[model samples]
Target: MSVDVFTFGLNHTSAPLSVRERVAVPGELLRPALDALRSTWGAAVREAAILSTCNRTEIYCAAEPQVVDQLPAWMAQFHKLESTSLQPHVYRYQQNDAVRHAFRVASGLDSMVLGEPQILGQMKDAVRAANEAGALGTLLHQLFQRTFSVAKEVRSQTAIGANSVSMAAAAVRLAERVFGDLDQANVLFIGAGEMIELCATHFAAAHPRGMMVANRTVERADLLASRFSATTMKLSQLPERLADFDVVVSCTASSLPILGLGMVERASRLRRHRPMVMVDLAVPRDIETEVGRLDDVYLYTVDDLGRMVQTGTDARRAAVVQAEAIIETRVQNFMHWMQKREIVPAIMEMHEASEKVQQAELERARRMLARGVAPEQVLEQLAYGLTQKFMHGPLSALNRSEAGEREQLLELMPQLLPRTERRR
Candidate 1:
């Protein structure tokens, strides 16, 4: 079966946080997950890459057409979820549609926060992971190279990213809405990854009374803290220290919740029920869902931040048409490249056949010359032999074909055969 571009999975728009979180693949498991995907279908999945972020988990593959239907099942099984429950939220895109979806995704046209630049970095990271896992082959490599190019073109040629609200900025806005003013609020950041760094930058601007970073790695936490002159603490210290901050932002890779109800409840009691704002930007959630019900705690997940960032998107929405036009042109070009690639095997076979014919004819010419045959007659025989060998297939097909097929062959013969000018 011919391999074609295929993309399958769900994102923030198609699935809610609860569903997305269930299937989210952590960074540490990316290589194993990729190996499992390719191993599950073997040759059916020729080339594969899994792009798993807090907002989406998509598998891009160069695979047989039949593999598309089975991909959702594989994803559900990989994540240990029931296929029936996950199938409805899944989407599949093939060939040109797959190419367009990738371009749009890299260009941030498909993000919850439209034109947000963070997703591009996240995609690059996914591609890097795929490369490290040896999951990337020619097709996916080309696709992603073009994807990056298209993203650059969209960002440079259009105003899609301008005046766009970032998730980090949105989180700060949400905090202010709850706390009235950030000047007196102490902020706690969980994790020292990119999202946390972005949130730290934005919250730093608020000039909060104090800022602290809690991470599993003290070195990473200290590194992030050094930049903002904030303090650093270990994750083990969170239960005792969680109530010190009025606002908390967490984005981590842990598969389970970092802050459970009991911990937050204890923190609330420590604070004497002071109102607190907490943002959980991790996929599986760094904070437990039940903790949101606490009377003194204002908890928000990545989805809530996404919705908050979407509010002022009208200004950036104007650039969507222009970005999409750019993506359409690029998508057509990529599909054309793929179409040309499909004919390569046929072209190779024809060349191989023609080479064999030339070799056979040349051998006959050499034998006649060695036998003391006239050079002119030998040349004539060689030409005739070459012509006959080249024309045999077409002539036989034309003779055997029925009326309609013969007529079609006759029409194609002119283009398929090289023209010969008569000697005067």
Candidate 2:
């Protein structure tokens, strides 16, 4: 049986942060999660690759119908959730659907912020992790290679990424709405994750008065801070220094809010109600929602940023159309390659049949020559034998037919046989 490429999982689109965070695989646990998936779904999946980012967790697999069909149950078991809880939030794609999904994801169309280029690097990292865990195979490897190529081609050929707003840019835009001029503000970035790094880059362009990176690991914070000529602080010191910076943008993998209402309230009192603009980009938001109610604190969650990011999507709808057109063309190109792959079995079968016929004829001819049959006679017998096998069906059909069918065969044979000999 032939196995088709399959993909299933939830993302920012299908599941809320509540459900998504429960199953979210951290980078450090990716190998273990992949190992668990392999052990649990071994029979169903021939090969597997997983990509789990802040916005999505998707599994790509090569498997049969049974394996593909049972994937949801396996996922539920693996994540230790009720099947119903996971099933509604999951979307499954098989064969070309899976291929197209992979391409679109790599191309950044499926991103929370459309056309963000960071996803490509994230996907590369996921693939590398899966490979390191010994979970990737030829199908997944090829799919990802083609996906990268499609992404590169789309980036080079279309204006999909051009003028697209990034989360970092959106974070800065929201902060500017709170604080008029960033040059007059001290900005604090919490965590040194990729999102924070990107946010720092955009904010640094504004030439903020001061920039500080506070991370759980001081080394990572220092590494990020040096790029912007900023200072680094430990996460524990955030409460003390929180009042010093006017703008705070935080996105971290913390299980709970890093900036609670109490902490912000204390900071607001210390700053003498100077009005702090804070954006919490994390899922389990870094800043508590109640902080928004504080007199001197302005807090925006990921949901708030989502609304801002969606506004400009309308303006870019035309460009999105153009991008979809480009994507469709590339999808068809990838599907064509997949289709050729599907027919390989039939092609191999035809080659094997032809080889069998040739070998049988050769063996008979060799025996004839060994028995002292004339060279020309041996060649004639071989040709007749090969021709008979090749034309057996049409000859048998013509002989069995009585009237009109025989006449049809007689007319079709000359046209069906090649006029020139097929080149060896």
Candidate 3:
């Protein structure tokens, strides 16, 4: 069975947040998930990597053709969901199409926020996890190596990322819409991950009246807070001090909602229904969905921010076109490499067979010499033997073939065989 490149997953465009969150494999679970993927399919899954982020949960694998269609079922089973529940949202690509999809995804062409750079980093992280899990093999390693190269080329050659409205910037804009100016509003950041750090950088530029970082780990929170000259707080302190902030931006890897409706509702009452802006960038969502219903709270999920960032992207359309062109070329190149790889075993077998034929002819020539045969005659016989052996398979095949196949072989024989120079 031939192993081909296969990609299966659902992104923001294909699935809602509700469905996405259910299948999201967090960073901590990535290796285990990859191991599960390989085990479930056994040898059918030769190599695998899972790229799960806030906007997508993609599994890129080098697997047999028969295993491609069953990937969705495996994903649903791993996530403890019914296959039917995920069937409508999932998308699959094979061979060249899969290569193109991977190139587009890494280049940020397939991202929720077009030209966003975060997905590339996330992809790299996923690759690293796959490597550490021993799930990476030659095919996937080469695919991602080319993926990163293509992404770099696209960014340098196109303006896809120029003047890009990042989610961090969008969060600040959302807050300003609620408060008009961040300079007078107190901003609170939840979690100390990269997204939170990015949000802090943007919000810090506004120089909010006060800034604070709350995380499960005080050390991490303190480290992030020092950069923005913000205070650090434990997550336990959020409820008591939640009403103190006018803006809250949260992104965490927690499997469940960190801020529930009851917590935010009480905080809203404590603040006398004062307007507060909240941004939740986590996949499963750090903040409760019902919090958006509160009269005093303005809550935005990752999807909401994705929509907001998509606006005013007309200027980047030309860059997108250029980037896609580059990606398409790279995809073709990668697929060509994969095709060559598929024929390698046949090429090796042919070499081995030829070597065996050469050895047998050499043995025959040595035996003829040992029996006192003429040296020149033995040389001529050796040459003849090699030539005859080389031509035997093709000649036999041509003879066995009927009219149509014989005609095809006759046309191909000249190219397949080496020719001697003709006398001038």
Candidate 4:
């Protein structure tokens, strides 16, 4: 059987964050998961990549059809979850559907925040990880290449990315709701990634009382802090100093929770039960879920931030029809390429046979010329011989074919033969 491209997983829309957090493969674990997936169903799965982000964790692969039956169980087992629990939220796409899904996702069409550009970078990261793990094969590599091209085309040609509220802006909005006036509140960002930088930019406009950036690497944190004239701290200081900030924003690539329930509880205690807003933008989540239950702590995950990012969606929606039209045309073009690629073997065979016929006729003409046949007659006979060779099999098949088969061949003749005025 032919290998087919497939994508399977759950996203923010397909499942709740609680479920997504459980199945999400963090950045560090993507390669391991991809390696396992490639060998999970023996030789069925040929190439694979897993795109895991705050709002989604999806697996894209080239595999045999039967591998579909085994994927859900394998994924659940890899995550150490019950297959039954994971099954209900899973969505699977095959071949063209899978190609379309990858393109839409890279274009930010399927994201929690429509037209969010972060996903494109995240996808590139996944592709890099998969390449590093040697999990990329011809089919998947081509699919992703085209997927990226289509995404670029969509973004460059359409208004899908215009007038959009990003998650960073949303984080700032959410903080405003709790603090009322951010100028008086001290804000601490827990990571120095692009999201944190964007958040810092929005938050700085409020002229907060103080701003601090905490990151695993002090150099990176300092670099970011320098841009905003904020202070920097090591990641380890969060436990003891978390109580000082009134608003906290975190977006990290950490595989495990950095801030646990006890840590947040201590912070709440130190704050004398004063209200504190926490935004956790990590996929596996930098903050513990139990922190959300703390009375004084307003813990918001990426999903919560998603709700606040819907400000200018009407504009994006207006462009959706146009975006879809562009995507559909690209999808058709890609599928047409794939269809032609599938027939390459037959095309090569036809060329090889035609070349052999030409050579054989030339050799016969050489033999006739050596026997002293006239040059004009030899050329004529060679032409006749080559034509006979090309048409003999088709004519013989037509003559021997049954009535129904002959009718089919007759109908196909126009396509198979070159049209001349006489034949027409």
- Measured with C-alpha atoms, the lDDT of residue 126 in candidate 2 is 91
1-424 per-residue lDDT for model 2 (tens digits): 6778889888988988677766777787788888887787575667788887767888888877677667777777777888777878889998778888888899888887777798899899999998999988877888899889888887887767778787788888877887878899999999999989989999999889999999998889988998889998888998798889999999888867798888889999999999888988776567777898998787876656666776676555566666666667776877788788889988999789889999999999999999999999999999999999988867788889989888888998998775777799
Question: By summed lDDT, which 10 consecutive residues of candidate 3 come out lowest?
Answer: 175-184
Q: Which stretches of candidate 2 lie over 4 Å from their true place?
A: 255-257, 260-262, 288-295, 391-424
User: lDDT per model, in order?
Assistant: 0.93, 0.83, 0.93, 0.88
Of models 3 and 4, which has the larger lDDT? 3
Candidate 3 lDDT, 1-424, residue by residue in tens? 8889999999999999999999999999999999998998799999999999999999999999999888889889998989888989999999889999999999889998889999899999999999999999999999999999999999999999889999999999999998897789999999999999999999999889999999999999999999989999999998899999999999999999989999999989998999989999998888889999998899999999999999989899989888888988998899889888889999999999999999999999999999999999999999999999998999999989999999999999999999899999
Q: What is the Cα-based lDDT of residue 343 in candidate 4? A: 90
The TM-score, computed over Cα atoms with residue i paired to residue i, of candidate 1 is 0.98
lDDT score at residue 303, model 2, on the 0-100 scale: 57
Q: Once model 3 is optimally superposed onto the true structure by TM-score, how far is the C-alpha of residue 292 displaced, in angstroms?
A: 1.0
